[model samples]
Target: MNETIETLLNHRSIRKFTDKKLTDEQIHTIIKAAQQASTSSYMMAYTIIGITDPDKKAALAEVSGHPHVTQNGHLLIFCADLKRPVAQATSEQYEATRANLENSEHFLVAAIDAALAAQNAAIAAESMGLGMCYLGSIRNNLARTDEILELPKHVIPLFGMAIGTPDHQPELKPRLPISAVYAENEYPAYEEDVAAFDQELADYYESRSTNNRKDTWSEQMIRRFAKPMRMDVTELVQKKGFNKR
Candidate 1:
């Protein structure tokens, strides 16, 4: 097997990080790698905010509910920014110009661009022997995050990443079985696939229960989606001027 494939297969999130601060060169290199990621239409409809301020980082930590957002040696925020395009269109609303605000294509472009950039940065950081964790909670505090970052209209936080040297090793996370995900030239067939997957997930959880964590896959999913969304992020994003269009 290829070394890169092996490394990717062994991928796991690292929460515990060393106190060592990364140098400027390392930071620049990682950012460079992120810039090299595939972008949509070369619009580069994404923004990455590097936080070095303690207060900002601490505030972000509060937003994420992940303490490491502040404690980690480095923190970066990935943003799906449609603000620039909106501004350009508004400013240059000439006879031949003016983009449709309700265009869903632009929103998709920003989101996909941000995701690609994030994956590039994650892989790059790992190659440098650095530990990193992605924070999906950036959306949990959407309006507050926009205020904190001073984001203009049509911009939204996609996620955040905390990077540092590894201090402790975490157990590998189990992925869904191929039968659960892979479909041969067509959409997945249900019932049999789902039942087989549920069992595999249950077994994986059982194995992890030895660490004093119940680790039930179904329980986790239930807890995540059972409750009403406190943030109502879709509405919030609409309020932010994307309008999900």
Candidate 2:
């Protein structure tokens, strides 16, 4: 396999990191790579906030409930931002622009743009011999996170990434089989594949080097969906002037 494919396949979410930090040039390069990611209609509706201050990182860590959020050498919060475009609109176009920006479609577009950029940044960090973990838990308390970041209207933090030198190497987690994930003309039923993958994942979880546990993918999913999760997200997003439609 090619080097790029190998990098992609060997990906792991790194939680433990060393004290070694990323250089300014390295951060710039990684962000430049992120900017190169494709955006819908050339609208790069994303903003990356790099947290450097110890107090701010601590506040964000509290928001995410993850110590790694504060321990990482570099923390980047990726936000879906429509404020810039909205601000750029002419007085005559302000109403129409605000209406479009408030639509759920634009909200999805902004979210997708942020996700794509973040994946690019992840790839770049991995290729550069750095380890990174995505911090989606920031959304667990979106209101507090927004307050910590001092975000304005029309901008929402989607997720964060913690990047630094690796202090631990984790076993690669097994993913769902391609048959379950990929389909041709239409979406195909993959109950059998999912059942098989559940066993595979359970084995991996049991055999992993650290924090070994007996759990199946299906069981995990059940725990995840059995209760309504992050129920306040919709209300918070609407408060930010998104998904009004």
Candidate 3:
């Protein structure tokens, strides 16, 4: 396999980070790599906020309920910022109508842009022998995250990535089998396949999270499906002016 494929296959989220601070040149390189990622329609409707303040990091950690936020050497927030374009259109005397300002397509473009940038940054960080972990929980405190980042309307914080040197190495987590993911032709019916896959997942998690606990993938699925995250996302997005259909 190629080097890029190998880098992707060996990927594991690093939770524990060492005290070493990233050099200014290293930070620039990572951010530049992220900027090099392809943007949808070249809109580039994304913004990155680097948080180094101790107090702010602690507050963000509280919001995320992840202790690593406070402990990590650097926090990189990737935001889907539609407001930047709104400002551009407004400044250029173009119609910054509400409909034009907020649409599912526009939202998707910004999200895709942010995700692509983040992945690029993550890979670049790894190339430098640095540790990194994606923090999707930054969205857990969406309102607070906006306030902390001083984001304007049409700008929503999607996630954060914590980066630094490694204090510990996490084991490679197992993934779903190709049969469970990729289909041969059209999508095959695979509800039955999930049960066995979940068993594998449960075993994997049990081995990883707890000390040899008898946890099954079925239980995890039940726990996850039992409480959804998006049911409340509508109300949250409306607060930022993206009222979905």
Candidate 4:
């Protein structure tokens, strides 16, 4: 594998971090890489909020239900931002309407753009020997987060990422076999492949150095699906003035 591929394959979420600070140059270079990620139609519908205030970090940690949110050397919240382009278009006498901004397709596009940029940032940080973890649990209280961040209309906080010097190097989590995820021309039946992966994951969980368990991937997923999660997200999104259509 090439250096980039090797960096991608060795990805791990680093929860524990040392007290090392990221230099301004390092932050600039990493964000530059994120800005270089592909965006649909070049809309670049994303905004990143770097949380530096102790009060804000503490509030975010409480909202995310993860104390580690405040422990990172740098915490960035990636937001799906349609406000900027829409406002600019309106200012330029373009037909920018609430309906256009609230379209489900636009919402999806913004979300995808934010995710792509965050992944690019993640890879860049990893390549630089910095440890990072994506904090999706920030969605646990989207409304509260919106309030805390004082997000304006047409903007949604998709996720947060915490980056720092690694104090703990975790083992890479196992993934499904390629056959289960990849398809040639036509999509093939993947249940058998998933069944095989369930066994492999079960073994990995049982033998892992930390948080060892006897659960399989399928079992965990089943438990996760048993109850609906984030039921208020749709309403919250609508309140943010997006996905109305």
Using all chains and alpha carbons, the TM-scores for the candidates as numbered come to: 0.88, 0.97, 0.90, 0.96
Model 3 poorest 10 in a row by lDDT: 88-97
Which candidate's lDDT is highest? 2
lDDT of 2 by residue, 136-238 (tens): 9999999888889999999999999999999999888788999899999999789999999989988898888878899999999999899998888898899
Can you rank all candidates by TM-score, best first? 2, 4, 3, 1
Give, for candidate 1, the lowest lDDT window spanning 10 residues: 94-103
- Which model scores highest in TM-score? 2
Evaluate all candidate structures by whole-model CA lDDT and list the values in order: 0.77, 0.92, 0.81, 0.90
Better of 3 and 4 by lDDT: 4
Worst 10 residues of 4 by lDDT: 88-97
Question: How many residue pairs clash in all the candidates, one count each?
Answer: 1, 0, 0, 0
- Write model 3 residue lDDT over 71-157, tens digit each, in one string: 776889998887776575654454435675567777788889999999999999887788899998877867777788888777888
lDDT of 1 by residue, 1-245 (tens): 98777667767888878788888998898899998999877878888999998878878778888878877768899998866654545455632222443356776778899989988888888877888989888667777777788887667887899899988787787666676677799877666766665676667666764454444566678898988774577776777666454
Question: What alpha-carbon RMSD in Å does predicted model 1 have with respect to the real structure?
Answer: 2.5
* Candidate 3: pairs in clash: none
Ranking by lDDT: 2, 4, 3, 1
lDDT tens per residue, model 4, 1-245: 89999999999999888878788887888899999999999989999999989999999999888766988779999999998876766454544477678899999999999999999999989999999999989899899888889999889899999999999988889888888889999897899999999999989988989899898888999999999998989999999989998
Candidate 3: stretches off by over 4 Å? 91-97, 206-211, 228-232, 243-245
Question: Which candidate, 2 or 4, has the higher lDDT?
Answer: 2
